[model samples]
Target: MGLFQPDTDIFCHRDALREDYQPDEIVGRDEELQQYIAALQPVINGDQPANVFLYGKAGVGKTACTRYLLSELKSDAVEYGVDLTTIRTNCEDLSTSYQVAIQLINDLRGSENRLKPTGYPRRQVNEWLWDELDSIGGTIIIVFDEVDHIEDDSILYQIPRARANGNLKEAKVGIIGISNDFKFRESLSSKVQSSLCEKELQFPAYNANELRTILRQRADTAFYEDVVPREVIAKCAAFGARDAGDARQSLDLLMEAGDIAVEQDADQVTEAHVDEARAALERSRIVDGVAGLTQQGHLVLYALVMLHEEGKTPTRARAIQDRYKIVCDRAAVDSLVPRRMRDHLNELAMLGIASRVERNKGEVGGRYYEYSLDTNPDLLLEALDETVDMVGVTESIRKRRS
Candidate 1:
């Protein structure tokens, strides 16, 4: 066998299909682009920047559109002789308001002058942020992507009301809060909500045709001319649209399908390649979702799978709690209280590992939630077995069956 395949030129520029790739153009977001442009128009006209909020499901074009417009705005600002400075930070790991402020201060200051990641009081951090903004002394737009990750809404309130509160004297600041959590906006305090949501835009998921267009555009640049066929692109789009209209998913499917074709020594990516890629993606997703759970979460999920295997699915929380207790006992770990157990179950449901259906018997019976495995029970068991020690768990399950 040869060391390398003779025909492995599946992708031209694979980076084009990646999540971080910032394309020269954004597709299927014309309306959104216009709305975003309108929101940032003030900065172009040398007026005070507007606070804008963007909310949507993951893999939508929220970040992409924001980046595209911000880039264009920065370029135009230079041409128009506007002193525009933009700061962007992802709050995924930086949760608290103080942490976000420290990050912003460090971002404003060069790395040489950056402060430590911790040890600052919230008030001191806010003072430092104000000082940095005052030093910039121009139109400053700060974008907080994954803003919902922030533990406190203090930064949101502080930034938008900086001028009115007299914290910012020279610089005019704008806040752009981006989040995939829809409820995050409403969860904010009324004051923070009123200011941060001054102008709000929602990015809806892309449909099949829209995803197809997006895939085609990236395919032209990502893969060889004939490597990805029209049907393959359509299939990828169909899958993404059927699920969540996630453009990222569509692009990922295309990229992975091409890689699979290359791995199999196939001449080109075909429907079979896409099918294999879909299976691989699903497996990886389930494993990642399972791996992210806490130990108790794993116990709860394992219990659900065991119940499902015994044809006890669509079970209520109380039944799952009982099974969870057994699994925990077998593993020699203490089980959580029923209330906390319910919280863990809800977390699992949020992570897409489990499903919760609300049930109400007529006025005679009270309402209850029915829980079931959202994914394949076999797959869930496989993921758990691989990620954690299931020897005792499997033995306990077997004993119960016997």
Candidate 2:
């Protein structure tokens, strides 16, 4: 047999668990689906389109739900004779209104008539966009997935108000702004908020039960009978719930488990494979997160990791700062001030690399925070070892720990 021999024993249809695969029925989002269907009801009634804002954490089914529902809406619009058109784009890299506008125009215009990504005034872009919408001459829903990445509220305010402001004569346009950032809505200007959030919908993270149902559904289609046992499914769902109630994470975990089983030439995926897959995913996440941090951030996290190994953690910021200074001195890098160090600590916590807790000392010491490594210390040390200039610090800490 060749080294790359096809193994059909594990996954019958592995692509079913992929990110782009849309399930026939969204298994766990009944409530959100009903509310979502209601939100799009205006499109079917030939009335003004509804401007909607969808907010949720990553992998909690925001984009999946949007695509699924839009598909259904389009079918219904055809049957009901409601002129509806939906255009979708992901704004993760589209940082400004001009970029987003250009993207939308290109998406509508197709490759032959696509405009350049740069070199156009904002007003001209808006005018072209309005002209395109007017030419479509019906209800148009513009879905901006990861919409929070756009730096300004200019596009958000402009698109929804296009028809009302007379920029669009025939097409009634609505905006569906989807974001994983919880604070993006509050960060928008008041006018943008009122205009874009006219029909706000929230997709809460999936609970363990919901995740289980979803995993099981995918497992049945993605694998042969009994290839993925119930315990493996449960374990993946539990891990996902503990992580963030993210369906995408859960699904990815399941897929990774299958891959592990295939690598081992195992007959079925087991809980052991699930555990191994979880650790592998976490290690990659830590590596990526650490790679994104600054030099000071690395030192701060290394200090916290050392403290954790020494059993000095759940310790306060001052102690970590002191150790950070020591790490910096040993590496010949200047230490930042305590205030700036604390900011790095906060950023680590936000990244899920560290955990923070608030402590009150009865108004005498006032309120302070205690920090500790939230991830595996060994994994963090390994990541630090790979980072520039941190190898010495990481080796020293490993020696001390050993």
Candidate 3:
């Protein structure tokens, strides 16, 4: 027998289950799709395209639906004999307006006339962007996905008003800004907000039944026939619904379960495989979450974990700060003050690794917040132990337990 079994392969096209995979047809987003198509209909009618904004929680169909419709729009534009140029850039990696402009310029001008990322004033960058758009000489739709990542709102204002401001003589520019941050629009200057928020659409989270349908469709393409059972898909969808109604999470769980089944030389993915995959995914998330923190962040979380193990949870910020100092000493690092430690605690809470609740101690005592670990303390300790040299930290915890 060979080292591996030829018949054990489960996946037909694994990429279909990936987060970035664009399906031929989007399921469970008809309302949102129609709204989006209405926003772009002006482009088809040879009118100025409206600036559209899409906002929602992550793992919803924001980016996917945008891409799917844009592709269709491009095809339709050709049949209408309209000159349409669509340029898409993910703003997550481009923080400043200048950076985004340089990217757009390079994308439109091609590599030969590309500008460097730096060494140019903001005005020059804007000029270069307008120049590129004018050269294209048609209705241009520029999409900035993860638009919240850009620190400067100047570009947001400049692009949407390019035509009215006489910046683009030939090309009419429309912007499609996509963000997971709900407060991103409010943070924008009033001027930029007016332009970009002309047509706003919100993508709600996918319900369990919706996720099930989506998973079934993707499963047909991603896995071979009869490899994934109906119950397995349902379980994955339920887990995703419980978490955040995230389709990406459900698909990831399904794909991971299939991989686990293959690894065990199993013939099909079952409920047990899905459970194991969920556990593996949870552990991976905990480890990756812990690893992404700053050194002080790690120490603070370790402190919280240690305190929780001692039944000292639901503790106050001052208590956490004191324990955090001991943790810092054990790790031979300087400790932050209580106020700064509170900030770290808040950051941890934001990451869902910890949570805070407020209580009142009557009129005299006023109100204060108590913090506790939101995740499994043992799993967190395991992740921290793997991520850093927690030998002294773990020993200190053992001493306290004794």
Name the candidate that leads on TM-score: 1
lDDT of 1 at 108: 93
Among these predicted structures, which one has the highest lDDT?
2
How accurate locally, in lDDT, is each candidate? 0.89, 0.90, 0.89
Clashing pairs in 1: none
Better of 1 and 2 by TM-score: 1
Number of backbone-clashing residue pairs for each candidate, in the order shown:
0, 0, 0
Over 4 Å off, model 1 = 1-8, 358-368, 388-402
Write one digit per residue (lDDT tens) for candidate 3, span 1-402.
887655436988889999989999999899999999999999999999999999998898999999999999999999999899999999989998888889998988776877877998778788888888898888999999999999989889988888898888999889999999988988999998899999999999999999999999999999889999899999999999988888999999999999999889788899999999998988888888888899999889888887888888889999988888887887788999888889989988877789999999999999999999998766776787787675367656667767
Show where candidate 2 strays beyond 4 Å.
315-322, 336-347, 356-370, 389-391
Residue-wise lDDT of candidate 1 within 12-64, one digit each (tens)?
A: 78899999998899999999899989999999999999899999999999999
lDDT of 2 by residue, 158-264 (tens): 88887778888899999899999899998999999999999899999999999999999989999988899889999999989988999899999999999999999
Quote each prediction's TM-score: 0.92, 0.91, 0.91
